[model samples]
Target: ALDQEKKQIEKEMESLNLAKFERLILEKQFRVLSYLIEDKKEKVNIVSCDELNNLLEVLEQKKQRRQDIKSHLDSLNKELACSNFDFEKAMLYRDLIDSEKKRLETVNLSIQQLEEKLAEFERN
Candidate 1:
């Protein structure tokens, strides 16, 4: 029964309407970061202040999206609680979702850190 509940939650999360936009934003930001890194490979000098500013904006937006998804997941958890649902099988699915969230959070943090580093570098 627990397994079934978790699967249900998984299905609901998977079907979340907002996930599509969230994923698109993430992918777009990731592509920009890739291009920035690639551009750095061709230049010997430091990156421009404007470039750093642009990247900071992108990172901030990405972080905001990450936070939004997290909040949505939290809301889903509350829904699960109110439903008084329990299932052992769902535990595995729940763990998977938690792990994926953690991974995305880690990436978000990395992006924030990189942005901070770039800001500091540009300041000097």
Candidate 2:
């Protein structure tokens, strides 16, 4: 009985560790999503005071981000189509995808405005 109890305890510890690891992964993923959505992922460049260069770099990042978002959304949709569909998770991904597209729109607008300003400056 003592040996059985020890084995049970070990199993419980392993399950607890797995749960903790999963929670940490979830937290990290959410943090990444938050940063990507908020345009805060590339802050180290802003410290250099090169607004034009930084803006261009940021626009490139945003373009890459839009591609990533679309891929993720596609994967989520594929998952939703599987035999074991997770409705809640699919809805969550849908919402994130919508927000990501909105952010992309804003980024595009910002890039357009910057290009217009540059053109105007060059004209003068």
- Model 1 gets an lDDT of 0.55
Most lDDT-accurate candidate: 2
lDDT of 2 by residue, 15-120 (tens): 6646533543454365355545446544555456546666567657756666665665565456446635367655655665566566557666755765665466
Top model number, TM-score: 2
Off by over 4 Å in 2: 1-38, 41-51, 84-124
lDDT of 2 at 61: 72
Clashing pairs in 2: none
Evaluate all candidate structures by whole-model CA lDDT and list the values in order.
0.55, 0.57
| lDDT score, candidate 2, position 122 | 58
As a TM-score, model 1 comes out at: 0.46
**Model 1 deviation from the true structure expressed as Cα RMSD, one decimal place:** 12.1
Error of 1 at 104 (Å): 4.6
What is candidate 1's lDDT per residue for 39-82, written digit by digit as tens? Answer: 35323232444366566655665576566556656754665466
